[model samples]
Target: MDLRHLLAHEVAAGIIATGIEGAYDSVSCSTAGNYPSMGVSQWEGGRGDNLLSWIDGGRKFIGRTYSDIVNSGELDELRAALDSEQGRAAQLEILAADCLDYVDALMPYLNDSKCVIYAAMWCPTSTNVVRVFVRNRKSWGYDVNNLSALADVFADEYYKAAAVGAMYRQGYSNRAYNTYNYLVTHEIAWELLDA
Candidate 1:
């Protein structure tokens, strides 16, 4: 199967086409990207994004919180570019920025940085909070067209969460990178084929 076309256009679009109407069609977007321990964020749209919306309260909170990281003296340059991507890409990028920021916020709660004093002592990497803010800024790019394409990124979060859990238990990661790498390859294929 052309996973790239499946992701970049057809299947991804199918998820949205069915999802926005509340018809409940979706694929298990992996929630990670290119790394085994990178963590996840929801990126499906149309129907898939709708599914995310069904369970995305936390995601919304993160977007606002990431903005706080930039605003609350954590870091600088947290502004969402309202006019960066062209057409649908702009919209997709906006959604991605929101979810990335939220997932970045989720990492700390998962890591329990509340007790790490170094988290509070350093410029960055000292705590999950600072780390997420930086990560989100870099992660949330401004060029995706179909917002549903976010499934590519979302899978990473789910995978990483699995990996971290596995690491703690038996020291074996969840192999999150596989799905991420697949999606990355898929997206690249999409750009070529769709073009």
Candidate 2:
């Protein structure tokens, strides 16, 4: 991957790791509706199963349920596996692929790296929502090049959608706002671009 894409992946991964796993090695069987989730981004369901297969040969917990693994003390084993260097690398690799896909999606609407990262961060949880916001903004002739303005539009769109019951969570707007502010405060996008 290019440096910009790599940096975007790293930033998004760190933010997602902080929000979900809090650590690279953390594993949770209950967070995602009792599905075994592992690593930084909580790769769960089919992704979680794929992660397990990649890291642990898929023999331990492929078809097994969460309760079976937990009762068999295999969850601890999974945690230990996730803590390994190979496991962390695998998780990051998968996360980077995911982040890059989001970046690609936003590139058509918002070319600014910061704005793209902000929207890409939401893709993990709300792909359709971010896509709609990007499409709407593009259709309205909004200036997507300005990160702050784009963020404001996103926040406004989020709230308006929530108000009309189009969106389920009011707090989700904060993610876009906070992501934009964080990028600006840290100059993350500029730094990446410079690199």
* Candidate 2 stretches greater than 4 Å from native: 1-4, 20-23, 29-34, 56-59, 159-170, 187-195
Per-model TM-score, in order, reads 0.21, 0.76
Q: How close is candidate 1 to the true structure, as a TM-score?
A: 0.21
Q: Each prediction's Cα lDDT score?
A: 0.29, 0.69
Number of clashing residue pairs, candidate 2: 0
* Candidate 2 lDDT tens digits, 1-195: 585576557556646544633466676675547667666777778887888777754447766677888888777777778777777778777788777777776777876666777677767655666777787877889987788888877676765643456464445567667777667676344665645
The local distance difference test score of model 2 is 0.69
Off by over 4 Å in 1: 1-97, 100-172, 189-195
lDDT by residue for model 1 over 57-121, one digit each (tens)? 22332223333444464322211211122322433433333433333443342222211111111
| Candidate number of the best TM-score | 2
